[model samples]
Target: MNNFARSEKKRQHAAVDARQVLRALREMKQSERPSRVRMELPLPQAGVENDKIVYLGKHGQLADWSGGMRQRFRATRPLVDTLLEGRQANFAGLLEDAEDGVGVWACDGDITVLTHVADTTAGLLFKLLRGEYGSAPTREGAMVCVVNAFWTDGGEKVGNPWEFKLREEARDVLKAGSWEVVYCLRAVRTAAGVPGTIWRRYPEPWLVLDETGRVVLSKEGSEEPSSAEVAEALNRTANATE
Candidate 1:
């Protein structure tokens, strides 16, 4: 009664333990596996030409203009006279003779230009510009917007050196060991009849590191520095260097 009963009891206990172990293993595998997502966002249409000129007025409304209409504005004698007197327009040669047949204009912080043939697609440009601007000095954050210019080879071309005034200043903070500029790049537009059809805009704060390697200007702050702030930082550095 003792030996046989003990052997049978042990066998039943072993069978139950084996089932529990198998169940636990299956649960663990299920927990570790990534759930499959059934729904996905549709991709935007590609290879479409956006030739409309959109001007963001001082009041923040967008005004659309045709290429011919824009050219008419350029033909105005008084405006041309004023531009020549002020040396505002970089019209050293005929507009048709311009490289890549593009023009660029900046009003306050808003920029308007012709689109390029290569970088005009929206999604690719957005990703490239996001990488350049979404980085913080020592942290990570998303950008509000990034405008970019594209080279013919699908590479983002840096805008005019003057346009980089803010980025250059942000670099100064890193140079002074106060911050670090982790990312910088250009946005490209390939839409037709746009001046510079390609331009670069900074949509994110420049990443930096303080002397102690601390993050100061993070994206989550109540106050993030603007391009002007970066320019100011650069100016301070320039004065110090001088």
Candidate 2:
């Protein structure tokens, strides 16, 4: 082959090798990363706007209430689907069993109830309408009564402790069925810019449970916990109530 043709062939071969290496790295990363559970709820037709919904706090104004409800339905459509199908679906339950059950539901900016109980079967089933889970009738309506799981690394510099702490406090609020409380976890970005890594550290396994005692999610720190630490935090939180 001509020199120019030979050079072009070599360039093409290099490009192919690079692409193959990148694909392999991506697959490895995906396999090593923790699993995440997400549910998308449907929104009401009358109140949705610009894809953003409001979450009306318990004492929020009527206008705010309407917007939040719309957003929540839009976000949790997946969980609603499972509920309607009469499947034994519980996000928190699954997490708890997996030992990575630190769950959170975004509430789609609408009203959401975080229940103290880990079991969410009954609540999920009750929300179904004609094999579908619909939005709450009012903007002030409450979505499912459970927290979804979220995972974070504590060893990072900017990690916020509030993520897991809020789950602990949520148990108390869940018992009251009062939506007056809101927990906020803040973390400042470090020089390295790791998200949610600068806050306090928790080495325990976090859990998310439905009201029906199902563990939908669970996560442990990269460092395994001692028997005592596991028993203290996990067991205690499992039994906590609002």
Candidate 3:
């Protein structure tokens, strides 16, 4: 068989095996289960910034490593609990929040919501009335849903919107510590014909490309990228020569 056919066959076999394993696990009686089995997985750590790890590409396809800064979207403890409820409820809440003008960024591999802290809105208004607007509350954090896999009911590529679930294992892993979340910002034209920036996630480069293949950072494009992007790209170019 050709490489594409072989890869597809392998993926099908793996999916079948995974389903069988899940079935067997579910069928096992509580009394018959062993109590000594322990599972452990490596966790991503803070203070370990690897710019080369950032990937961008289409879902269900190979990703390209695009050097970028390791930006973390902070999330408070309470915000995480709400997102872990389930996909349906979380999605509903997302739409409701969006109606309130809350920001929601969604692309291929991930979806993020800029969640607010409880009572922050009312508290901010009260403070503003008292001329304390300078000290008003800021955006608490974001809820990030990292998509793991995509599946269709009819075995077709196109299907319903992707659902998210915080598995037990993932919950356990997240309990270890705080995880960094990155937000992608893009530039857009405002109603007044002025340039503005907004939170958006896209799978393509924000900067324009020159004739020599170098990126040109234009003022009309996305927000100013972090210096880390250039530094990391330079490091990789140097290493490639060596």
Candidate 4:
């Protein structure tokens, strides 16, 4: 072959090799991207605005209630789909069996979905899960507080505690019905930040039961028991069990 022809062929081969490498890199990146989980959050009776769930305030104003669930709550698509189908019995059975039945965490007096103190994301989850607005309301039930201190490094920081309210209704078959109560005790993000903006999620998103015994993400923190103190108590309980 002529020298110029040989040079042109070499250039073409190099370009093809570069294109293949780029395609491979793109595929690898796509595979690395985590699959997003769908959450089963029911909308309030107030309905949606600007593609966001909203509720009418006591003062006749509309407030956005999407909160952290929209930004932070993560789960598998199949799990969410199952919950939506009204078939969370298996999941609930798993959670019930997941924890040892050696301890009890129950609530007292009237159940309040939100502390209504600072309107945190946890508070929003409690309201949405319990159907405090336009959705179905919770019936007679018991309560359990699930505390997770993993993010706090063995309860050092003490993430928020979740109130798992178990509601009960008469049915042909017996099942567990649960809901969540929210309290704004500790700030999920203590650093300086602007209002109406979602910061990092503190503690951890956990499973809780609603009025229908369906599994849902429980809200964080509480006003009365105090999330940090609750976690400490839970730690003590774990130690005692061990």
TM-score of each: 0.18, 0.19, 0.18, 0.18
Best by lDDT: 2
Cα lDDT of model 4 by residue, 123-178, tens digit: 32334345553232243331222221011111222223332221111110011112
lDDT by residue (tens digit), candidate 3, 80-185: 3332233223332332333222222221112232332122122222232233422212222212332221122112322123411223222332322222211122
Instruction: Note the Cα lDDT for every prediction shown.
Output: 0.25, 0.27, 0.26, 0.23
List CA RMSD, all candidates.
28.2, 20.6, 20.8, 22.7
Candidate 2 to native Cα RMSD, angstroms: 20.6
Candidate 2 lDDT over 154-239, as tens digits, reads 11221235545444433432333222111111111222221110111122243332223233334454332233443444344444
Which has the better TM-score: candidate 2, or candidate 4? 2
Give lDDT for model 1: 0.25
- The predicted structure with the larger lDDT, 3 or 4, is 3
Give Cα distance to truth, residue 242, candidate 3, Å: 36
Off by over 4 Å in 4: 1-75, 83-120, 126-131, 141-242
Please name the candidate that would achieve the greatest TM-score relative to the true structure: 2
lDDT of 1 at 68: 32
